[model samples]
Target: MVGVLERLERLRAAADLVAGRIPDALAGKVDDVLARSNRRLAVGPQTVVALAGATGSGKSSLFNALTGTRLAEQGPRRPTTATTLAASFTATNADLLDFLGVPRRHEVAPPEPDMTDLVLLDLPDHDSTATAHREEVDRLVRVVDQFVWVLDPQKYADAALHQRYLRPLAEHREVITVVLNQADRLTAVELSQCLAHIRRLLDDDGLTGVPLLATSAVTGEGVADLRRHLSRLAAGKRAASARLAADVTVLAAELDRHVGPARGSGADRRVVDDLTRRLAGAAGVPVVVDAVRDSVRHRGTLATGWPVVSWLAKLRPDPLQRLGLGRRPELESPGLRHSSLPARSAAAHSQLSSALRAVTAELGEDLPGPWRDAVAAGVREAEPTLGDRLDRAIVETELPAERSPAWWTLVRVIQWLLIAVVVVGLGWLTLNAVLGYFGLGVLPMFPLGPEDGLRVPVPTLLVAGGVVAGLLVSGLSRLVISAAAGAAARRARKRLEYAVAEVAEERVLAPARAEVARHDAARAALDRLR
Candidate 1:
């Protein structure tokens, strides 16, 4: 036989199976019965007996005589009992028998010492030829660990008893006891004949192994055999507990049908996959790509030969409007403003945040642990304000209004200076030559020979050209500074996008998986109870 814990598990499994199929009324009753049985079983090995029969069968009288007390009513003028009754006295606390809902029997008796668990319930007689009394007996009989199926000499062969209770319980032959109670009323020859006839009826009822004893409450004839049997049962040295165990095993097999097979996988992977897909979309990588592209173009133009026109870079609808990515730079001059990469990137991050919030909220009903708290916090943190930072950076840098490649700027300055130099050089040489040819060379470096006669020196003019070239070189240097700043801003936007995705993953998405694991563990524990 299985051990107690294993037995309990089987019982629970059995209960779980028919738990649904059983009608509500029957189910509650079974639960009550099983719950009480578990408490009683906690007392260890014991036998329980419910002495049930027709009115005036001397069942209660015989029970009192066997237990050596008036444990149940005996002076019965049979009106067919109107109420159910029970009494328990044993070394073991057999009070658990009361959980069966049979009323306490009216009795004058002393409590017995705890020697062994034995309960003898004196139930309202069934076969009372009364419907209500019959129902009561049946109810008590269903839950007893074993039954002492008391019968009188007159009813021992009654067709109703044979066909109804005794016949069905015949299969449980070892657990049943049938007595021809009040048998002292018959003579020896008649007693033997009555006993033989009862055995034949029992055989007809399919219960050949059942033990039969003849007893009288008045004469105490053959009572010791019944007590000895009850004692052995109470000691759990009875074959009946093992027999009932077999029945319990059958019940366990029935219950097993309800418990599903065990396995390790405990999650719906599809849910997480769906979340990942949605979050990636919300990150808006495409928008960031567009912004970076524009920045790259502006940088390339500045590097090649775009002139001060570079400052004319325009971003529409305001960079600040890109989700949480804030305003365009505060470059006061339309001439110096460039890249909207940062704003576009920020928009992508916004999408990712909303997606995370949505998925988390979707799972909120079941969300467990830090994941629930983290997702809510992350969305709040995502709201950004870049307004004043860009404004301050732009204002502090005295960027020029016009923009162009340093090369273009330098080329422009050089061409102008060269023209001036060539013009003056040619003019001076021409004038000096003309004048000299007219014999004015004696006046020397008065190169213009006084067209307006300020007598400017050719060397001095050459020095001015050199100064202009130096200024052009300075202009180109500033262009490089502006182009580099734009490139850096472009890179910053990309970095920010990546940063947002990382934060959302760590704070929001990752925690959700943990929540699934935690709650699944909880579910697993509950499943074990069944």
Candidate 2:
């Protein structure tokens, strides 16, 4: 189990982590409590107990009786003691008094030396009609190590005392003592009835186990008992720590109401995958993939088609260039060049928006209103930059068509050899026709089938065989290139999608997830205090 000091430290860490995220009022309270607690701990081990009550409650007289010295003055006025009067039982309490901001201080010698480290304060009336007096009491109440509430018979059950002061201090019962002052005024029967009523009222305020007694500052009816109680608290030397612990417990409870459940792992992987696909679509991945396929086929045709018709292929547009993609010198520097891919269609924007909303919904699920709003706000802030990020991802991705495969080179060589044979046969036929027209000796023929029965001319055979073989090779190359184009398109799609996924994670998921992590951190610290 964690100690009170450890819990207090955790509470401080939590408060700092959630400073700007929670409500201003709650955040301010956390700051004020921590500041007071730290300053109180720094002063000394001396227990600083305060006499807190409404006007005409005889707090000043009780203070004088407890110290055996007239440290605080008593008068017939409605409100007395606008400032605090301190009585330190020890010789070296000037530092503590200075820290408490009390200028009027006195040293006292008590019967018990064990109470030497005690420092008692006579505070202003908490319910005083004077605003300054009430403000002084309220300020000291927050930092005092313990409280002694002095009540009178007539107003023992005053609503302002119970509701405003006692009820809120219910968690600090261990550091609080209640006394019904002026007990000498009431008869025995009436005193018994008042004590019973006070008991019931304390129970209702959730301060059931707190010490209660009746004392008259003048006759000293229960003053001896109150002194002993205060002595025990001082001797133990744990009152300050106990008081701080109670303060932390109350703050933790209030903060826990605003903390939601923890989601430590961040965005779900499945949701991320869905988001990647949507982002890829918005980035025009499909268009890029189709361009890759068409670019490959266009280049393949120029490389392997018949020389006669190959010049015609140059007349058509290059698919990759049309999209402002492929291996361009300007595009070598990442993020500097934008593609000519068309503007994102309405459907693409809708999908992108829907995907982003899904991410926000998942992150904000089960969270408190403020934290959920924080997550959504983070996503919305990043939404405008997403389009630019996606475009950059697409431009930077390496497509397959950017580098030609080795097979295309080998096929191109074979096609040139076939074209060479066709050229030789066509020249031979033209030379033979010119010779025969000029009545020169005719070129010799070659035997084709059974030598004497069937013979064919050499030029005709050369011309016929080369034409048939060239056409056959061209047809086969078309099938292979088509398959290769499809495979290249598939590879390009994979790379583009990968790039888009990175954009989604960096631009969309990371920030939203960070907010969730922050909430979890604050919540976990508060949980330890519980």
Writing each residue's lDDT as its tens digit, candidate 1 over 296-368 gives: 4444344332233433544333222332233335545543544333333566566545565665565544343
> Which lDDT values do the candidates have, in the order given?
0.56, 0.85
Say which candidate scores most in TM-score: 2
Look at candidate 1 and tell me the lDDT of residue 67: 69
Q: Stretches of candidate 1 above 4 Å error?
A: 1-48, 53-65, 68-79, 84-117, 126-145, 150-224, 237-256, 266-275, 278-307, 317-321, 325-530
lDDT of 2 by residue, 1-530 (tens): 67766887898899976877778999989898888777778888899899987788898999988898877889756776889988888785776788778888888897466678788999988888888888888888888899999998877788988888999999889889999999999999988899898999999999998999999998999999998888898999988989888888888888988785676746777888889988888888999999999998888888776656766989988898788888888545776978889999999999989998999998888888888888899889888988888887888888888887787677778777777777777787787788999999756655376666767666666767767766776678778889989999999999999889888777788888888889998888888778
Q: Give the TM-score of candidate 1.
A: 0.43
**What TM-score would each prediction reach against the true structure?**
0.43, 0.95
Candidate 2 residue spans exceeding 4 A from truth: 264-270, 445-447, 450-456
Give the per-residue Cα lDDT of candidate 2 at 241: 89
